[model samples]
Target chain A: MATAATSDIKWWAGGRSPFNMEYGKLMMWYFLMSDAFTFGAFLISYGTIRFSQNYWPDPNHVFNAFPFAGHANLPLAFVSLMTFILIISSVTMVLAVHAGHHMDRKGVIKWMIWTIVGGIAFLSCQAWEWTHLITGHHPVLIDGVVQEIGTTVSRNPWGPDVTGMMHDGMQVTKTGPVAFGGYFFGITGFHGFHVLSGVVINIIMLIMTLNGTFDRRGHYQMIEKAGLYWHFVDLVWVFVFLCFYLI
Target chain B: MQHSSNTHSPEVTFHHAPGDSASTIKKIVRTTVILSVITLIELALGFGIYMLHKNPDPSHALILFIKGVIVILSLLKAFYIVGVFMHLGDEVKNMIMTIVVPLMLFIWFIAAFLWDGNAWRNLRNTDAGHRPAKQEQVTKPVDAKKPGGIE
Candidate 1:
């Protein structure tokens, strides 16, 4: 016969947390799970469209611009920076959670600020990339004639790079798959929204910590829950980076 | 499981070694290094694909293989993030499974959607009435007279 401490603990006793988890943390985990599906649907639909197309734009060929490099090609460089920012932010968040575990209020505030800065940095980079794509003058050969067009959801300047025409030393390509821009902007934009909300959440948590909310409660469980959401945002970025920038 | 000092408090925290901040920091540092190294390798693979595209006749299979490798590496990075950074690994087994099992549906989701997309591609390519001349599957109409501008 199992003892009351081990296998005999009544899971449905209604008083104890049967899973040995805080209900708040459990709900946060569930919320993240559902968010995962949202991103999953976006990425999968992107893949579906990509598979149906005979010619798709190579991300490297499209995303090879640096901020101040003046048309110098740097494939995967900017997005790599974005990825590191997110990863490092996730680390700081973990540290914040760790510090919260010890009730180290100063440490939590410090790390939370850094994480917020990182989130803003990522958003700024996204803004620049989006601006570059939308307003940036890209020449493409729509039909048999060359046309100056920037990438839009309905039009992608990069088609099959067959006609080796050059305008001002820049390669003029064909109209690539229109859906490419749609999926790229749609998924990344959605993820950016998540990051935006995450930053907001972290700020609120930071304020609560400053006011000693956890101190009054005697546990930093709120920070822990927020950390899960922050890390989930970073997690989704890993895939978004994969789907849009890398492959 | 009931070994924690606080009995009335329902929050179940994993055991932390008292006065062991250094060791915990060390673990965080190690995981950070692991994550960075994996990302670097992924970027290297991405560059390799880019370099291959420069070739006049790049092997398609090789590119696909590299892409496959990148996806797997992404999954590995995801694992470390959720496990170490998010602290999911420290949670109980059934708790982990609850978060994980629903995700398995993605396998079927990706497979089915991609399968149908490929089928659509095939239908357009092989169907006589709908097929564009040769392999030029221009689903969008070519409005040549409409000047190039943002839609």
Candidate 2:
């Protein structure tokens, strides 16, 4: 009868009542849902600002990096690599969870380490990309002339003297308060901050797992919880890629 | 809950479990090949639009059509991941829907905002020089050599 019930009990039916899972998985899912909303709000705000602006620069033009050759239209590559890394990490995570089911501590640890490494590599690449963008590697076309976009008014769409650089790396001089640079920094910076946070969380999990915390608990729920967060991170990146890179 | 050693029921079996290796590697490879072909088609269409369309400003209608295709492709991929890899395919309907439906809404909300916003920007580009309600007398003629509505 119990075996029959096991096969028959629907997940949502069980969702109503507490089952074998601890509060950890539920709380993790709740946290992921909240994080999803945060990313959604950011994307919506990005759309609003991009729409309001008259002349948005092409994403392809702004993000071009030729792999090992020269900086050239390869914005998609870093993001795509990030996507693959996250997906591969998630696969490893699932394998960890499977190992947990069998009580294979060593197997779980091996996979968890791999996932953590992928997360760190992804964060590093994102940091490099963010620095390049902030430094103005790609200049915008102003008034039909291409010029350096940083604090120097080498050239711009609004004609000469429209923009200038400030002493600090933070401030950029442009035609008005709502120049393109402001919007670009605001959107990309917000997403980059999320990646940084995700990296920190992954590191924390890695340290805990290494210390045999998860092994002692005898519950793979932590692995599943980490998977949920990791998957959410990857999902947000997909949208970020589309909105910031392809769009 | 009994913690049975028997594999008779296989309580929490993974689709890609490592070695009795229930799923063949060939199956995973086949799925990849099929998905890659679809992605190639999308790439071809994207390049075709960029090359053939003389009008840089795609009308709202065209944007909407392209947006529809993008959403469909994305949904298909999402479902494949959830079903095949997540092993939610053979699960109950409510569970499957629970995983899939919210994603659809999420994609729709973001795409709608992006499409509507880009349309407004393109329209503004047509009247780039004139402020909507600000009336300023033109003491000097507008610069003819400068491209006014260029983006």
- Candidate achieving the largest TM-score: 1
- Model-by-model lDDT, in order? 0.87, 0.55
Pairs of colliding residues, candidate 2: A66-A72, A142-A156, A142-A157, A143-A157, A151-A165
- Misplaced by over 4 Å in model 1 are A1-8, B1-8, B11-19, B128-151
Candidate 1 residue pairs that clash:
A159-A176
Tens digits of per-residue lDDT, candidate 1, A120-238, equal 99999999999999878777876778778888899888787656578877788878889988888988999999999999999999999999988888778899899999999999999
In model 1, what is the error at residue B12, expressed in angstroms?
4.1
Candidate 1 - CAPRI tier?
A: acceptable
Q: How much RMSD separates candidate 2 from the native structure?
A: 11.4
Candidate 1 — what's its lDDT?
A: 0.87
Instruction: Encode model 2's per-residue lDDT on B1-151: one tens digit a residue.
Output: 3434322222332222233323433444454455445444444444443433336566757755765575466556555544443445544454345445665676778778878877777766788546576776768666777899334
Q: Give the TM-score (vs. native) of candidate 2.
A: 0.66
